[model samples]
Target chain A: MSFSVDTGEIFGYLGPNGAGKTTTLRVLLGLLSPTSGTAIVLDADLSKDDSMRRRVGVLMENNGLYDRLTARENLEYYARLYEVNRPGNRVTELLDFVGLTERAGDMVGNFSTGMKRKLGIARAILHEPEILFLDEPTSGLDPEAQHMVRELILRLSRVESMTVFLNSHNLDEVQRICSRVAILHQGRIRALDSIQHLTSAGKKTGFSITLADTTQASEAEDLLSSFGGIGEITRNGNVLGMMLVTIHAHEVVTTLVKNGIWVEEARIQKRSLEEIYLDVMRQAEGDVA
Target chain B: MSRIMVVAEKEVRQLIKSRNVMLSALLFVGVFGIFTVPAVLSGMGDTGAMMDTLGFYLVLTLGVFMGYLFTAQVFLREKQSGVIETLLCTPLSLRELWFGKVLGVTIPGAILAYFSAILIMVTGSAFTGQTLVPSLPVLFHIIVVIPAFIAATSGLIGFTQFILGMRENQILNFVIIFGIIFLTTFIRELTGPEFSVTWTVVAAAFGLALLLILVTAWLTRFLSRERIITTLSE
Candidate 1:
């Protein structure tokens, strides 16, 4: 679980529910004193002094806004807590950034879950913190809202050049934006690497070939067998299945046609992140079967 | 400009915006309106003048209101709304957090106490045709009494609520608050102590404040922290 987050890069802290994700963030924020081990954030010993929290933006799932205050008031309150000067303009900028400008005067109690989530993010980033820690940030957001949140994170990282440490149980959500991911289980690090490195190491690509007839299919299969990196080819009716190899997918089709096998269709199969996550978890549990 | 100052200001503004704050202010004012008549009658026969008698009664009024409002909102709202978690996440030191809350809640509360005192002075002046003598004793009464009352009320309310489970043990807390307020009033009325020994009252106020603080700390150390961590774990 010891890794560094580079500035301007998105890092996903992937783990199971209650796998110490929130606890880890809390320690980093200096809200919790670690029982053992160290949480070093921005060169400060988080356990010793929490003054660094002023430079960090954090959004917790279901951490509701003060229901009695307007959206503007809530932002102003956090800005003040972070000691941001001239909080009024910062409040306006954050409201606009979250598309909450129109609802700035409205009580946050009346807002929808998605709107509240957006506002929570706005409050966190109001002071332009150097790092952002978002825990299950898009838990209940719809697809479009999730996309907007992702885009917002990207914008913040690129424009502000901030480091983001994201904690989520959603793997696809991680893959969509994270430059790197660390998988955790049972209070230990199971896997830590860039997505490209891990996928290439532990996973095999898969593809389904849909052809016209058995003669063409057999011919394609024979050609594909000699074509380096096809694993366990299977056939039924006019369909063909194989685990793809280290070689680029286009190389396979080019090799097929050169061998006089008419090309009908070739597609590299996709593995869902959920499947990969399950595989990683099962491996951690010593239950490959 | 400082983080603690920001948090303190926000807390004060929040207390002001709540309906509970308005009602508490109005209740203290209503007490002044009612106490003013009797205060003036006492002043008509006084050698010391209206302001001195009015000042003592103002202290009494402030004490009761402080005891009541300190419990109703500051203790109840944070417990109910779940905002306490977010507040604790700030970089505010624990000492700063505690003092900030006490100050924020008490400032408006002190202003309300002063409002009642002014009402008493005005009514005493108008009804008895006696101008208030704003002397050193009158100043002493306000400076000592208003803050003592505020501190005592905060101690009583905050300690009981944070320790006894303000959200869960409603009946137990209500009984405790009722008993404390009732006993304090009953004892003060019976003591009939002289004004010069006012430090005795201050001592008693501080004693109550310290007890509340001790109970809050013990609960956090022995019980509340584990409960919060376990609940979040689940």
Candidate 2:
């Protein structure tokens, strides 16, 4: 339910539907008050100090744009609101940054969902905020658009050194960009760790081995099944795939080779973020049951 | 520019872009000014006094109505669209946001009200077969009092819209429409032929508007970002 993001770090907050991800964001952004707790942002209690909000930026599920205004007008209005010096130039620069200079004069109501999301991101970074909060920024974006948004977030973190608090259920996005993450389930944090640690530190590991001799596939499978750490052994066309518990790929290969099985390739597969998330959710549900 | 002015200017620009709303306001003012005067002033005995009185009260009524109409567009529309959530995150205080929007609505509302006053004068002159000009009191009322009244009414409405939920705002809209209609028609009929459009009456109306503005300005202290955010339609 609570965590701290380091400076210049992209902290991904992952949760399922009705998991209070949006509600938590609203509280942190000072839109809603917590019933019995405090949310502090930028070394100030968000509920008490209104001025602290100037240092923060938010892009909610809605783009928060005036559809009647052109893209240029929408950005300029927000730039002025944030009191950015040289607002006209800033507006132009942001338009170019988001690749909307040609369509800056177009009304945002005419923009596609991806274009709207791009403009929404541009609006969020207009003030050069110390911390940016984005809820589902790339939720409905096309693959290319999603790449652009993710690249933009990385640029903000690396180039601008901006701290980003990203709330999303996109496991690939979290794995690709976030250094650390907190997974929420049933209004509680089930796991909070660095992406490296979450994906690497788990007990279950997978290994895929290809045999030079097709006849040795069954032999290799039997050899791994006889081992204490190997589980769920499956073989297909001289390839042996199995789950490893408390065992390394080297040991599996060494045992197969010792048993007169020729191993052509031995590879250790990393568990994906999606796997970690689903495992955590399943555990949480079993606990509830 | 200061943040308050920034917010106000944006509101003005957005309101200007809303062509349908502006066109409707003009059409409503034109219809009422051209049609209503001929029917009401033709039945009167002292046409000049009646015209003067009508100009006085009618302008104020139209000005308030204009304020009501535009307040919903500027304040309530922003809240409904969820743009206000982003604005609230700015350093701009709740009062600044409210006052800026009220100022935005008042400027356009007063301009439309002025056009309505002119339309009333021209249309009344044609219907009565005499050159009718607004008296000194009516002139002051149009030039000074009507804009102030518009600002006050819009401020009150904007404040209420920020504080109340969607259902309450709908009810408030109905009340505002009924109130404006009742005052415009029923109060004008109460004045007899002997009623004179004097400076005292003008001064009294100005004082009342000023008082209402102060009261509404004080009411803005009750506005909070939490209230506005919670009232926003999902």
Find the candidate with the highest TM-score and give its number: 2
What DockQ results for candidate 1? 0.40
Q: Can you write out model 1's per-residue Cα lDDT over A1-289, one digit (the tens) per residue? A: 5778887788999889867888777777665667887778888874466577677777877554787789998988877776788989989988998999999999888998888889998987877878888899889989888888888888888888888999999888898888888888776778788876665564578887777556788777777777667788988766788888666677876777687766677777676666767888989889424
Lowest lDDT sum, 10 consecutive residues, model 1 chain A, at A195-204
Badly placed stretches (over 4 Å) of model 1 are A62-64, A212-215, A218-229, A234-239, A245-251, A287-289, B24-72, B79-82, B115-139, B155-172, B191-234
DockQ for all models: 0.40, 0.75
Candidate 1: tens digits of C-alpha lDDT, residues B1-234? 656566567667777788866785677576755565573555355524445544655455555466456545665566565565565555665545555666666677776666677776676667667676445655555665556557555654554454445444468566665765676466445433333324454456456655755665444333232233233312
Interface RMSD of 2: 1.3
Q: Report the C-alpha lDDT of model 2 over B1-234, residue by residue, as the tens digit.
A: 777787778878888889999888898899887888977787788877867877887778888888998999999998888888878777778888888888888888888988998899898888878888888888988989999999999998898999999999999999999888898777677555667879998899899999999999999888888888888897
Q: Candidate 2 docking category?
A: medium
Q: How well is candidate 2 docked (DockQ)?
A: 0.75
Docking class of 1: acceptable
What does the lDDT come to for candidate 1? 0.69
Question: Which predicted model would earn the best lDDT?
Answer: 2
